[model samples]
Target: MDMKKMAGDKAAEYVKDGMVVGLGTGSTAYHMVNAIGERVKNGLKIQAIPTSKATEAQARELGIPLLTIDEVDHVDLDIDGVDEIDPQFNAIKGGGGALYREKVVATLAKEVIWIMDESKLVDHIGAFHLPVEIAQYGSKQAMARMEECGWKPVLRVRDGKTFVTDNGNYIADLHLGAGFDIEDVREKLGTIVGVLEHGLFLNMCKRMIVGTSSEGVRVIENPSK
Candidate 1:
């Protein structure tokens, strides 16, 4: 089986009936949504809260029952994708511009599981440009502040226009120089104004299922667990 698909299938095994699940967005996460759809069709009962409008529409098309976060106090589990996962299990996500919503959903979940192909694993992060969601009004100020912090902040444009996220914010893709501590980086970025959210996720992933062609699959648990 394709490694990404295999990883999603394996993660789907953790989904059970009568639970609230947080659905993620991305190619890898799309596979998981399909797997959950098949289970729902087979009479499995679950309510899903999608982190992005794209994911919400896709899940509805697949007939997976959906609910908004306002309706649920907590999510039983959250399965999402990551752009880069470091050795410490800290991750950078939001390549799809869903980081703000993804973070909200993830932090609310009792457990968060990241599913990915082995290619996303890294020794240290900052390879893929980090995504930072900033309010449009003062976005220029935010980018300048980010540059002051030693990052190359580039405004993301899609189809010749500013890339607007589902939340209607602009994106600043930060090319952070490699080899920095994830927590330190997050703390530094958190101090900037107009910075609504960033892709750096720290100490939030409870489990990670990595799919490999030769190994089939590997499930790594959080060391603190």
Candidate 2:
């Protein structure tokens, strides 16, 4: 049933005309961006801010009008994908190395929606290694600090080279293991000098769209909404 596409397309339905939208990065977000592009072709009007260079290119190719973050006071909505989301709605993101920009966009949006397949939903979040973006200049020291705290930090690599994000930072995937304290870890990571942003998305999402092969698409509103 292509659950990723299902969830992504469903999230796109929330977009309306004359609004400013924050377009997210990742595989699931690809579908949402595509769906929105189709709408734009049919005369839907909205200004979009892409979370990464990859997304910006896609949005440009799709004829989606683009805006820089500095041009917008606030985004009406932001839809992105999560690597892992727990029952408490805490999520692990940045699997695509766009965590820093994604976090910034999400923070500027009035509403945020996360789209993912049912497999991403878990009883807890730590199973998926938390991604922390750090400045390249002192990345090694940052990783060393994380390792000292037992996070088991591993630098992300792609094509035999270190994976660099759109913000030109390095990503360290932290293996927190099971039953770890989310708040404590987040606090500790923030204390690191070179740490720019981490993948822990807490208390931000207003809704989540999950796609399932059996039941089709499910939209869950945040309890705090």
Candidate 3:
């Protein structure tokens, strides 16, 4: 079975009528958006904010009502995917280069849900390189600063060119190894002048749904929620 599809489709069921939804980016999120689109075709009434241009286009093609962030007072629920997630519900995102916008949407969301396959679960979050979005201006200096802190920053490149995010920023993936101090690294990254946002999503998830081979789809409510 397609675990990503299982998790994503399960999360889409949470969207109720007359709610403002935050549609996320990436492969797993693609399934959620597709499921939500089907509901829309069946008369689900909801306005949606897409986290990336790709998501926006998909939602538009599916006739999902699109609304800018400015048009909505707040997002009722934001369903997204994570690269890696710890037992504590902390996660690493931005593998899709949508971290900046994803964070923005999550910040304004009253509730957040992350859907993922079982493989994404981990004892710690550092296995997946954390992505930090930075401005192009002085990016080299910023990366040098990150190196000085031993975060092992690497500029993201795609198709033989620097990968630019939809927000027109560069992503620096940090190889922080396992068991690194999340707070300390977050603080240090924040001090970098060119840094705009990092992939560390701490305390923002309200629930997590995982698709497992054995159990099928499992839902874990955030204890802190």
Q: Could you tell me the lDDT of residue 191 within candidate 1?
A: 95
Score candidate 1 by TM-score against the native.
0.97
Q: Which has the greatest lDDT?
A: 3
Candidates in order have lDDT scores of: 0.92, 0.94, 0.96
Cα-lDDT of candidate 1: 0.92
For model 2, the local distance difference test gives 0.94
Q: Select the stronger candidate by TM-score from 1 and 2.
A: 2
Displacement of residue 15 (Cα, Å) in model 2 is 0.2
Stretches > 4 Å off in candidate 1: none
Which pairs clash in the backbone of model 2? none
Better of 1 and 2 by lDDT: 2
lDDT (10s digit) by residue, model 3, range 36-130: 99999999999999999999999999999999988877999999999999999999999999999999999999999999999999998898999
> Which numbered prediction scores highest in TM-score against the true structure?
3
lDDT of 1 by residue, 30-57 (tens): 9999999999999999999999999999
What TM-score does prediction 2 earn? 0.98
